[model samples]
Target: MTMTKIAFFDAHSYDRDSFEMWNKDFGFDIHYYKERLSMNSIELTKGKEIVCVFVNDEISAQVIDALVKNGVKLVALRCAGFNNVDLPEAKGKLRVVRVPAYSPHAVAEYAVTLMLSLNRKVYRSTQRTREGNFRLSGLLGFDMYGKTAGIVGMGRIAKVLVNILKGFGMNILAYDKFPDMKWAKENGVKMVDLPELYANSDVISLHCPLTHETLHMIDKDAIDMMKPGVMIINTGRGKLIRTEDLIQGLRSHKVGSAGLDVYEEEAKFFYEDHSDRMINDDHLALLLMMPNVIVTSHQAFFTREALQNIATTTLQNCKDFLDGKELVNEVMAK
Candidate 1:
């Protein structure tokens, strides 16, 4: 039996160990990289049949074309988001498959955790307490028992969020292009218009993919429509929020507090250690300066369950495609 040759460009330090642990049965010639996948990576993947990628990888037209030219047939993504890949260019050029439905509970729980941390100001208080100051003067947190939570998308993760928030006794208001009427009725979630969701929700969480229409969807106009002191949480793609406008909203108290796991310019910063160097993205720097903002380096999907699931699914996607079966999680261009 000929072992498959698969190259994982932009593979994280954590990925190799986890993948090896899960797929021990496979006869794979696995190649790893510490840096990001770019046009320069073309030469590295010259003889490989498949290339596995992650969130921050550059899957541009040129890169995809080069991969196809170099005998690479499959693009297997370990993560759910595919905005980095140029799908139109990849259409018919490469068979792209992603781990679409990993642990939704991981992301949904992270979103709520951010909301609670911001409401109680835990990040600030924890820092102060570590320095021998045990003051609790400004740590007043409201009960989320009756507040309405507006979910912007109704994907699997958002559905899990609705169920979790229900246990907190919170009302649910959701807006989606194709509303989940049955789920809404079963879960007591009201499928409302976008404007209504903005005006009514006490906390708003973003859970959709990034697209041209959704890029900066939380801009000035959307912010203006939102209720004052509304808490914002995003565990989805970072490009959905306009970072500059979000900063302004925080400044004006239009947004009371924010819990963000992703950022617009995070590709350069996340998965890298830059504590010794100057931070380049001014918006990210400024965001760190704010006392009310809570930012995590995109670790919402980093649970042990999620990681194992991701690695298993990604490897299976490659093996399944090579076996001439239909894709289990294929990304088709609409």
Candidate 2:
């Protein structure tokens, strides 16, 4: 049997380690590339049966054309979100499969981590303590108990987060286009509209996929509807919230604090070290300067368990395609 050739782009040390560890079972001929998949890097896909990519890799229409020209049969996404992929372009040319659910707990827990860290000024406090300044003047936080938490999108990760937040005695208000009434009732979650969730929630955590209708969903208008000093947490796609609008909200104090695991224009900066360089993006620079905001480089799904699951599911996706089996996790253009 000929081993399937997979070109893994945007390869990190951890990614290589995890995938290589699991590739033994599938016996795939995997080639790793540190650079992200883009027009310039499209040549790497030549002669490969599949191209594996991550969240930050570019899978534009042009890239799709190049992949098809390169004889690539499959595009295996190691992550859940496929906003980076040009689904419409790849529809007839190539099959796209993704790890729909790697480890929901990893992301859900990270969202909670950001909430707690922001509320308690954990990051600030840790820095101050290290400097031998024990003054607790700015370290103020409210009890999570009895606070209203509005969860945008009750997907797998959101459901896990709901259970965790419920333990804190939080009133869960959820908003999903297709609300699962049965699940909401069983979980003690109140299904509300976006406006209601924005108005009532003391803390708002976003866990929705990015779509045309949902693009810039948390713009100035939405921010205006939110409760004063509402804490915002986004562990989902960054484009879901408009960065400039969010900066304005933070500046005006409409948003008390923000915890972001992703950024709309993070492809150039995130997942890479920029400590030696200056951040040219003014909006991102302003956001980083804000004490009330915490920006993470999309590391919510960085847990060992999640990485393992991603590798396993991603390889299985390729194997399924090669075997002419049903591609259960295959995503289509809508």
Candidate 3:
């Protein structure tokens, strides 16, 4: 069967390799575009039924209209975040599908990895050991067992995170709009309201989406409600926690440490190396300067298993849309 061609925009070195390795079984005419996909790149997707996008691509209303005009019917996002996509504009214009929960364990484990690496100062100690310095000073870390973990959002990633922490006997306190009471009971997790979760937890991790209601949810008021010296981890959307408020928390000793995998303005510089150039974003620079803060380049979902699953799902999403079949991961604009 001759498969429908799919144009993969922002097909970086890593992205192309991962997609090619997993999508060999699927009959897809994959055209790779290493450059970031913008409205200007709409012509490249012409005659293609689908366009697969990455984290860096701009899929706004203008781009959506352009894609439709260029004969693209479906937009498959390999990543989970849909903030960049103008869903309302694309409503009935083009089908939008995403790999919503591809390898939740990958992101969940990365969150824990950040927590442990920062808590024990493992990265610092490893650096010193390489220099033949056997100093244990300033490397103290508290036990995770018996510690209280407050998880915001009880989504797939958050559920896996809670389960991982459960192995260490960590008490889980969760907050969500539609809290999973059954899961909480089964896991011995306490589903509390937001304010209590903030004020009482030893470690607070955000696993929520970025929406108007959730924007800067961890601002000054939320930070003020948090326990002093509490550790904050955000492996989810960056806008959930205000960077300025986080800086204030770090400076005021309200937040002991931060393990961040995403940032609000990260689309500008992330997935690209700029060693020779000076940083243009002051907020990122300020966060980087903090000893108690650690940032990863939105890499919580960068594991091989996750990438393969994402690629397969993305291709399938495109195929489904072209075949006039129901899209399992379709994001319908309300």
Candidate 4:
């Protein structure tokens, strides 16, 4: 029996712990690297048959060329989003598989958590109470029950969020390229066009994938269409919202508040601790200075259950590829 050797790039302690725990049962020889996968780091996969990557790994055309040269047969992604990988370039050369659904509840719950925190001024109240300044001067919040929520995508994660929001007695309006009318009718969600959703929703949340059509979808025009003082929450890919346009909206008070777990240029700053260094990204720095904006380091999908599921699914994908089984999780270019 030939043992399959896999190289996991951009690996962290949590990744190691979860993957290694499952590897004991799979009996695969896996090597872990702390550095992210890029053209410069391609040599790390010298003799490996499979290379595993995360959300931030760079799998461009150049990187794909190097992977082909390095005898890599498969690329395993531990996360759902695969915009970073060049699918067109890797079509005939190598196969790509990803964990499509790890834990939708983790992300959906976090989205609501951000909405509640921002709406109720939880963060500000915590800070104020810590300093013994318990005064309810500016901590007023409106009722979420009477407002309308527009969801961009109605996939598994979005469905979970829609259910939760429906429990709060909020009206639901959703838009998707391929709309599921049956699901919407069953869940009491109204299917609407983007313009309608934007114009009527008091709170908008993004759950769409980042693609050619959806990239920078929330620009100045979209912001202009939204209700004034509307709250925005994003746990999806960063490029979905244009940072410059968001900044412009914030400046003019067109967007009242924002809760973001991802940013467009977050590759250099998201997963690392940069408390000691001065942030060099001017746009990110400017967003950080705004009190109405809350920026997290893309941690919505970091729950233990999600990590364990990701490890299990990723390993299952590797096993399926090696055993010549069907790749249900394979992502192909559209």
Candidate 5:
């Protein structure tokens, strides 16, 4: 049997550590590149059979074509999301697989953490205490119990989040194209329409994928339908909510608070230290200044367990493809 040569893009210290640790088992000829996968970076994959990418990499049609020209057979996404990849272009050109369910608990717990932190003013409290000013006047927070929490998706992560919210005595209102009636019946979760979820929920969290229909789903019109002073949380794709619309919502007090782990144009800002340089994104800068908003740099799935799962699953996907085995996690455009 011949060995598989893999080219990994968007390589970071943690990503390298995890992949290197797992690669010892398979012993494939792997090369890591710190640059993200794009049309310009296609030359790096010359003669490589598999190209591994992360969430921030650009896997557009041009990139896919370039990869095919470079003899790349498989595109292994280390993350669960394949929105960055052009599925239609790669459907017959090259195989694509992803780590669909790395650690739902990691993301679900982080979502709840963001909600609690935003609700209880944990960020403000930490800042105040650090400055030696212990004040509780502005830190008043309501109880999570009995509050209606709307979840926009009902996938693995959303189910985990629903279970966590249930533990807190919070009511669950979920919306999914294909409703899991059995699971909802057992968990006492009500499957509702988008408008109902918007008008009724006190706290709204987004877990849907970024598709043409779902893009900017939480726009100005959607925000208008939501309850006033509603808290919005997004750990899903950033493009789901229009940043300008969200900013306007914040100004009008339509959105009481936001806990975001991702941004629409986060590729340049996230996973890098830019403190020494000036922030060019005015919208993002304004969000950082807002007291009610909490922005994390897409770190919800950064736990050790999730990283391990991602690395193992990604490598196994490549191995399976090379061995002519079934690609269980393969993703294609419908």
Candidate 6:
């Protein structure tokens, strides 16, 4: 029997470490690539049966076609979101699988981390203290207790966040197309409409997946609906909030603070460091310059536990496929 070969793209040191450790159980031949999977890198998949990709990889229709041509049978996504993958094109050509629920607590806790860090001006204070300028002049933060937190999306991560916010004594207002009424009632979370959530929440955190209807959901109109000086935190996809509109909102004092783990154009710059080079993306640069905004490089799901789960689940997905068993995490076209 031939050993299974996998071409893993957008692989960092952490990814290589986790996958290599986990591959001991499966004994698959894995080739890790530092560069993202793109048209130029399609040649790497020539002899591989599977191509494992991270969030930043370019998995377009053309790339999918090339993968099929290169004898790639599967495209395994290491991350939850599949917005980057062209599913329609890969319908029959390629089988796609993803690690959908790897350490929800990691993301939920990160969302809360961003919220607290932004609200308390922790980043600003730390910078001042480091420079020997500990002045308590511009650092006034509101109490999380007795505050309203609106959460969009009632997925695993959102539920975890709800529990955390409830512990903080926050009134939770959640909006999900398919609301879990029983769960919400038990957890003391009020299921409300988007408009109601927008109008009432002191802090709004986004956890929804990026879809056609949800793309640019937080634009000028949504910002107008929100409370004055609202704090926005996004641990989900970046396109959920329009970057240009968000910058305008910040400048207009409509959005008091923003904690972003992802950005719309983050693919070009997120995982890799470009501190020495100039940031060509104007919107990203502007957001970074803002005192109230905290931009993270999409590391909300970077916990050790999450990495292990991702590696195990992803390899299991491959094992199941090769064994002709039902793939529990297989992603199919709608």
Please give the RMSD to the true structure for each candidate, in Å: 1.0, 0.8, 1.4, 0.9, 0.9, 0.7
TM-score, predicted candidate 3 vs. hidden true structure: 0.96
Candidate 5 has a TM-score of 0.99
**Candidate 1 least-lDDT 10 residues:** 20-29
Q: How do all models score by TM-score?
A: 0.98, 0.99, 0.96, 0.98, 0.99, 0.99
Which clashing pairs does model 3 show?
none
Which residue pairs in candidate 2 collide? none
lDDT of 5: 0.95
Off by over 4 Å in 1: none
Model 5 lDDT per residue over 1-334, tens place = 6678899998989989998998899889889999999887889999999999999999999999999999999999999999999999998999999999999999999999999999999999999999999979889899999999999999999999999999999999999988998999999999999999999999999998898989999999999999999999999999999999999999999999999999999998999999999999999999999999999999999899999999999999998998899999999999
> What would the TM-score be for candidate 6 when compared with the true structure?
0.99
* Model 4 lDDT per residue over 166-285, tens place: 999999999999999999999999999999999999899999999999999999999999999989999999999999999999999899889999999999998888999999999999
**Model 2 accuracy (lDDT, Cα):** 0.95
- Over 4 Å off, model 3: 1-3
Give a tens-digit lDDT track for model 2, residues 184-265.
9999999999999999999999999999988999999999999999999999999999999998898899999999999999
Q: What overall lDDT, based on C-alpha atoms, would model 6 receive against the true structure?
A: 0.95
Cα miss at 160, model 2 (Å)? 0.4
Give per-residue CA lDDT, model 3, range 1-334, as digits (tens).
7767888887777888877887787778889987777977878988888888876789888998899998888889998878878899999899889999889999999989988988898888898999999989888999999999999999999999999999989999999999889988998999999999999999999998888889999999999998998999998888888999899899999999999999988888888898899889998998888878998899899888988889888877876776789888998777
Cα lDDT tens digits for candidate 1, 66-183 = 9999999999999899999999999988999999988999999999899889988888899998999998887888999999999999999999999999999999999898887998
What are the runs in model 5 whose C-alpha is more than 4 Å off? none
Tell me the spans in candidate 2 whose CA falls farther than 4 Å from its real position.
none
lDDT per model vs. reference: 0.91, 0.95, 0.88, 0.94, 0.95, 0.95
Among all windows of ten consecutive residues in candidate 3, which has the lowest summed lDDT?
Answer: 315-324
